[model samples]
Target: MTSGPDPAEEHSADVAELLALVARQIDMRMPEIVREMRDLLASRIDDLGGDPQLVEMLQASIEGNVTTICHILANAIDLESLQPTTAAVEYAARLAQRDVPLSALTRAYYLGQSMFLRIGMDEAERLGVRDRVKIDVVRDIADVVHRYIDWILQLVTGVHEQERRRWWSTRAALNASIILKVLRGDSLPLRGFASETGYTLTQTHLGVMAWSDLDADDPARQHELDLLLRRLATAVHSPAPPLITVVDRSTAWAWFGGARLESDALARVEELVMAVPGVRVTLGEPGRDVGGFRRSHEQAAIARLVALSSPRYRDRTVVSYSDPQVALVQLLTKDSTTTATWVREVLGDYAAAGEHARVMRETVAAYYATDKNAVRAAERLGVHRNTVRQRVDKFEATLGARGVDPLQVALALRIYDDLILDGGDVLPS
Candidate 1:
């Protein structure tokens, strides 16, 4: 008697036939597949400074990466030594040379893998295989994909690191000068250099000022600062890799693009403060255009300056220019002489004294906000009204019997509360 088709043989046949169908159609579907990917990654095109050539090359490169996976699925190639292109390694090196951040470069790999998963699932459905065989094929493809991604990341990161050292060592000075020129708003055709640097001038920018009060002489610490900036970039979603200018060993200025700081980025930065020691950071609100770029940096400069001045705020890990007090301080005080003279004339002994003086400055500021209402000030301060009244009395006694105007005293106290700073990074670099 002749046996019907064997179950085991039938199952293997279905799986093989399904894989073959996908492989055949993968090439045919390349245009639609790649278009979907381009649509998903459209936001990133501008991050490459919106250059047509760079965007085109990035699209082509992603298509190549995806096509290699299609071949692997067809079983024509082993994933072992097969690279999508030697072009990836060369591209990594070229991006490094162009000052493109490693984070931004590798993001292309991640975005490709994401596209593969989404497009793969959709393509699997269209294969019209039996449900049982379809599940097995999808499961197996996913397993292999996870492994491929791990391998590819290691390969790309190793090459990128190797090239980055060479690039940074040679181009650090040139990059720094370019950053200075951009921030200074020195009239220059910045768009031409955008491709070379991978930083955009057309987008909104968030300025940052970071410094350490400790020693600046150590090159290692300076490198640590550089690493911190890179970490900050990754946290913020690579809004055009941070353009950093090292002012000295102790301080640096950096800018990242985006309309606002993402909450996760802010949260990650809070964590970073603990990881990187002795670092203080301040950020300006997002600003647009070339003039806005300079203004944003000024706001960051003001935030940094004010943070340094306030005894209460001295140990703060990060400050934002959006702080009303920071904005007020920046707008009201500009000259070093005027800044110092106003504080001395108003606060008297409190300007030079210890933490108690700092507390009194806060107490007085609250009092002003409350319109000299001791009860409201105490409520705002979470202290006893008597305590609020005593501080107010002491402030008035120090200011003298004639007494300064409540408005004037309030403004000076808030200024001191924000900073008793001497010529902070007030002047943007």
Candidate 2:
């Protein structure tokens, strides 16, 4: 027309026309691509056997063209060559988003097959870039994404396990601390321990003692002992509260305070001990204060020793200080056997002399037995009121004439009884 319409203007018009044509083609193809992608992804989801609701949501999003799949591909793909069809490009975008380990393999296979099908053998062969661009590029990108996702998942799982173990360790340590505090005869901070350990402090304090055969072959006895301590703790309650402690593998100690003892607490302890063969219990007396607790424990220890020496006493039961025999046993422990022997020897002659000697001995024995109770002694012997009076009179007369004090007679009788039962070889000589 006019020298082929100025060269620069013609070139510009040709570029604009080409760009418009490409935009129109994409607009027309996008709907079909979306529909195809939705169908394929739905089929894959069904094969995966995941939740139906999640699958349906993914299907609806794809069918609605909610994601910019084509744009995502445009950014990721090589632009030097003609791009693949929207379906193939969207498939690659979906695979990239999924970040699956084998997604690269799938993407490479699809890209290679799609390129082979779309281009004639001659064009693909001439490009010489087919293997590098189509196969290697997709594989390299997908591999990087897959490795990242795997690393992230592993990090999350590792962190979670570490936190769980720490939490458990903290809890165990707290429980042990609470138990130790109680065993030391210190008051338990129930609210504080409960808050820190995540355990209820109310009714948590208990008292227990552990005993094992001096010769038993249980290597796991320590573990068993802890279990027994926990069981006994659960069964007891107190205000200051009892706590568990391992005195040794063969012995454990528990203490409880601030709780009222039922009349049957001792009975219950005995029952529990009896059920376990060869186990013994030495229950401390209920004490209202620190001083009382010390005395109570001392009494319990002495009672246990006495009980061990006497076969007639029942096993696995509390021997209260108020028990008459138990009191006598404690008294004997407080005095020396040598002193008892001397007293018995010095008093024996007077006790053996006449018919009045028997009465005087009976009176002396009764005086000590009744704790010097003249009236109670009469009642115990089933004698006439005056007969006990007469016996007591004779006792004083015999001791008085011998230049012995009435108090000495009483002391000699106590020593005689204790020394005989204690199995001391020294007799009145």
Enumerate clash totals for all models, in the order shown: 3, 2
Candidates' TM-scores?
0.54, 0.39
For each of the candidates, the C-alpha root-mean-square deviation to the true structure, in angstroms, is 9.1, 23.3
Candidate 1 ranges beyond 4 A from true positions? 1-162, 184-186, 212-224, 245-251, 262-265, 327-344, 347-366, 378-401, 418-429
Residue range with the least summed lDDT across 10 consecutive positions in model 1: 420-429
Per residue, candidate 1 scores C-alpha lDDT tens digits across 1-429 of: 998999999897777667667766777888888777766665763444455655566667667766777777777366776864665666667666655666777676677677687666777898777788889878766766777777777887788777876566445566677777766667668675576566778888888888876667765566677778777767767645687776765888888876457777788876886677788898887888777778888888888877765554667898888777777765654564566577677778777656787788788889889888999999999999999999888878887766778777766766654444443323221
Tens digits of per-residue lDDT, candidate 2, 33-80, equal: 455554555555443125464344434444332222223232332333
**Top candidate, metric TM-score:** 1
